[model samples]
Target: MKEVLVGSACAIALALLAGCSAEQPAGPAPATRPLDPTAADLVARAGSYYADEQVLQDAEATLVHRCMTTRGFRRPPPAPAAPVSHDEEWRPDPAHRRTDGYGLARAGRGEPPDPYFVALAPAHQERYQRELVGDMARRATLDLPSGPQLSYPTTGCLAESRAQLYGDVMEATRVTSVTQDLHNTVYLAAQADPEYRRTLARWADCMKRRGHPYGSPQQARNALAAERRSAAPTAAQRHEVAVAVADAECAAEVALPGTFESLLRRHAELLPEAQRAELNRLATSRAAALRHARQVAQR
Candidate 1:
């Protein structure tokens, strides 16, 4: 699959895992930390600016199909309709862990091949690739603050799809990307906070009690990765599910999500006013884009 313009909430879960761990062993902190109103408002504001990644994926698929078929190519199979959630601000929860189990099974179920593309002649395949994503030699780039530079094509079905939804593909890409960078920034700041560390230690202890000996969620995930390599496929899957379930349970026991949210709020206040304004402007554009995307998706 071609990479999307923005990241999903789950994409940030890796950083969340690291932020939720501790260096020093300690008991869980008090579970009653008062929520910060300012931070809550900031998150609420940020969430308003974005849709779930699945929604964008499905919509773009619709647009891409239209663009391709107009150029006389065979229409690809329609993308399945995604369950839409406009203001989804993802936080780690045990239910997701129980169901996805670190997403190994989902990862294993690789993307299906496109029959139309597969049957194409080599020359036609080259045309298809160019039509889908444009020239690889010439690309547009965006240099994000405190993040790596991002580049993509300025033409083709991919570009057309993005333009249809975001109005200005390059600018929208830069604008929407800020939320992810902000999330990364907050997570890094949270890692150094003593309160967050203490809560993580409690979570570690909780996991240890449940028969998973791990100092951090990242460590447990690493161990699972190695286990997948060494153990039988079935056995590895079973082990992964067991450890993931225990990890979620321990996270709950230690009030990990609540603590992390508190830390997010505390650290989020440090963001510059200019960045916040950018987010607000992006939200306006996103809302307008989603309206168009919804209509296209329905067709």
Candidate 2:
């Protein structure tokens, strides 16, 4: 089983602050231009990469298991979880909205412990780690054209798998970062839009009427997190569920999801030609990688 690295509560709080924002602004015009062919292809390719990587990971796990067994060790192959569908990431589902507050908390839940890892002896565990990550545990830093340097492990099955899928790790990282930045820009734009702000205000008012006064979804999430730290952790669960349901209700009442999606679609059109070309390149690369993955898995 993978060790659940529990950072200090302070660190976790800081991380939550850095990673999530409660408020999402109103979206773009409904008739905004559709995604161009290149962009559409890129999106499809990016989506497919998840499945491709699973294939590669499975193959890599098998290789590792075989290698370990040959050395007189009992190591079971990895069991990858089913792929999650993110089609509704932006879409609001009224039926299940109440089940997970904004769905963010639910999405962030950690994976269950791996049975294979749990069965290993302490010495074998150390040996397995060494073999998977490499004895030297090498690291490398790639200086990106923008942002902070990308530091990555230069050893391990994880590293090897990535290398096999994306030939040049640094280039792949750069491309991924660029795509992410594009999405972030769109999100920021939506947040600043007057229409989005108005809808958010309406949502806030709705929540207030429900006896859960919150300025934004982020505030509610933060409050729930703080409550969990209290002596009665489970006590907050009911409140969390209530708030989440209300959040979704408010979002639906205001047509916030539709607006957000419209804005995202509009912003996607603003992607630069160079970025589109890079996405195309990435798509081609991933296709090849997927083929390679299938062959490796078969062997």
Candidate 3:
């Protein structure tokens, strides 16, 4: 468990697939069938351990602002709330498909530059970074479950803010990575299971009937992702909506969401004892951090 000391001094912060060529009509929203009581209970239990990222980011920015202002730097504007996550499901949720589709174009457009920071001289900017984040030469690192290592400043205002909110900053970070790992593990497992493969085949058949010819939802999303970069933004978004509508309809036709949830529940039950203990401990830490974050954000 390496403590991640690396963070942005300014404040450490924090996908659709597929292209349809023509803009198809987005009719009534597809129905996402309600999960059974057992599945719903599991989802609720798992969800409780996680804090809202946007709220947490808001809290962090607030803490960083207060810390920097006390130290005499002009305050940076509040960072925008984190965008909705695409990986919330294997496919886009109903609202996401209807609204943003893949929403790739919208990325990198919303973050406002820090005017106060921008006005500083080059020498001053370097000093600001050091003061805001801590020593750039020294780093703290955490290895993600997905094989990538994340590094950040551990000694700056960002670190102090994180420590204030989360008792053990590294453990707090680990909670997120661990849960992400769990989701990836379970999702891949779901894809491997016979029942899920059958559902996917049915979904593929549905997509074929609709003229998408995609083998999996991910494949469609991938194709769209590639196409979006070349096409006009408006055209790409419209195509996304059209494809997303078809994707949702096909997913409903096979009850893919429910099937995935069922597999997730089953996989969670089978996790190793050590991993489960880790989750329980991390969840407790996250719950406490979330409480403090809410208080900070409110102030």
By TM-score rank, best first, the candidates go 1, 3, 2
What is model 3's C-alpha RMSD?
20.3
Model 1 root mean square deviation, Cα atoms: 18.1
Please write out the lDDT profile of model 1 over residues 45-125, one tens digit for every residue: 334333445566778888898889877787656857554422111244456565556766656667778788889899988
Candidate 1 TM-score versus the reference: 0.75
lDDT of each: 0.70, 0.63, 0.70
List, in order, the clash count of every candidate structure.
0, 6, 15
lDDT for model 2 comes to 0.63
lDDT per residue (tens digit) for residues 56-113 in model 2? 5566566556665665667556566355333242344555655554544454578877
Cα lDDT, model 3, residue 3: 88
Residue pairs with backbone atoms closer than 3 Å in model 1 (clashes): none
What's the C-alpha lDDT at position 45 in model 2? 32
In Å, residue 284's CA in model 2 sits off its true spot by: 3.5
Candidate 2 stretches with Cα past 4 Å from truth are 1-74, 82-127, 135-138, 143-146, 168-178, 271-273, 290-299
Best by lDDT: 3
Please provide, for model 3 over 1-299, each residue's C-alpha lDDT reduced to its tens digit, 9 standing for 90 to 100: 98887654333322123322445789997553333433323233334322366667778889888887777787655776666464343544677778877566665588778788899899888877887889877768887655778886677788778888887667656766666676576667767999988988999999899888989877887898888889987888888888887888888788887787678767665565555555556656666777898898667
